[model samples]
Target: MALDIEQVRHVANLARLALSDEEIAVYQEQLSEILEYASSLAELDTEAIPPTAQVIALPGVTRDD
Candidate 1:
């Protein structure tokens, strides 16, 4: 899913950014690549995978008074 120049401009506008033509072109390509990668990930089989909040367990850090 490649992003067009207009979409990139809209995203920049939403972020309140003022970008030059060159910057917009650069961002357009980068953002499109990210979306394409995410789209590919969405096609994977994850039915056996379980959802979790964190990958590693964290020990308690608070000290008792």
Candidate 2:
């Protein structure tokens, strides 16, 4: 989904950002592209993949309590 200028302005306002017209235009395109990429990722099939908390093994760091 593409973001409109108004939506970008609202988001910037919420984040307390002071953006110039150029900046808003730049961010509008960038943020919209990011959302589009994420939307594409959402279409991926990962049902056969197992959920994981970590990809590598890690040793315990805490001592006996």
Q: Considering every candidate listed, which one attains the maximal lDDT?
A: 2
Candidate 2, superposed: residue stretches over 4 Å from native: none
TM-score of each: 0.82, 0.88
Top TM-score: which candidate number? 2
Off by over 4 Å in 1: 61-65
Instruction: For residues 1-65, write the lDDT of model 1, one tens digit per residue.
Output: 99999999999999999999999999999999999999999999999999988899998899987
- By summed lDDT, the worst window of 10 consecutive residues in model 1 runs over 56-65
Q: lDDT score, residue 52, model 1?
A: 83
* Model 2: pairs clashing at backbone N, Cα or C within 3 Å: none
The sequence of per-residue lDDT tens digits that candidate 2 reaches over residues 1-65 is: 99999999999999999999999999999999999999999999999999999999799999989
Worst window of 10 by summed lDDT in candidate 2: 56-65
